[model samples]
Target: MLMERYMRVSQAYDKQVYTEDGIYLGKVEEALIQDNSRIYGWQVRLENPKIKEALRGKGIIVPHTLVRAIGDIMIIARVSIKKEE
Candidate 1:
């Protein structure tokens, strides 16, 4: 479902997050907000097995600008996979 309006941050907790291409990234662990009271991003816990290994102990931070939609799940614009050197 398309979100009609802004939602409370509390409503977003535990929601599964995915890339536009359908790769499961993780769940919404926390929301990042600006001092002006605007949400700027989210702190997503790594859940995908492959990403978990690459991320090590680091958490994923998705920028709000990349967010495509919000509903039962949050669909984000596809993120480029960065290969480790």
Candidate 2:
């Protein structure tokens, strides 16, 4: 017999997040929802030491489109963030 793993929104909180390039980005601080059924985005609390200087005092919002996988940790695609003017 085989079992399947199912994800729950509640379990996402505090889960570690990483990039496909192997960058330990941060932990899942919060999640956004749309229409009360779809996940809109993820608010990741930046914590990686490698990019600390660039991301200091900034929280990353990973859009659902960028999310690659959701298992032990969240895996997101490599993306460039543009500052809003």
Candidate 3:
């Protein structure tokens, strides 16, 4: 819950994440913590079909620093998604 404001970790999960430009990215799957004190990043399930297929069904990790705000919905910086051949 270190994104802009703070909240319970439980409240963090299942939050729909979006890019700053308002593109729906995914939902918060897991929060990456460090040493048990700090959160480093978030593991987000790929909801966008194109991104999901490009990621091979894997999730994306958004760094904590990129997070702008968090509440009912989480806002973060735009992430780069490259579809591999």
What is the number of backbone collisions in each predicted candidate, taken in the order shown? Answer: 0, 0, 0
Ranking by TM-score: 1, 2, 3
Candidate 2 residue-wise lDDT, 25-54, digit = tens? 779888899999999988887787656557
Candidate 1 lands at a TM-score of 0.82
What residue pairs are clashing in model 1? none
For each candidate, give its TM-score against the true structure: 0.82, 0.82, 0.81
lDDT for each residue of candidate 3 in 1-85, tens digit (9 for 90 to 100): 4555557887999999898899887899999899999998888887888778757966888888888889899898776433223
TM-score comparison, 1 vs 3, better candidate: 1
The global C-alpha lDDT for each of the candidates, from Candidate 1 onward, is 0.80, 0.78, 0.81
Q: Between which residue pairs do clashes occur in model 2?
A: none
Cα lDDT, model 1, residue 29 = 86
RMSD of 3: 4.4
Clashing pairs in 3: none
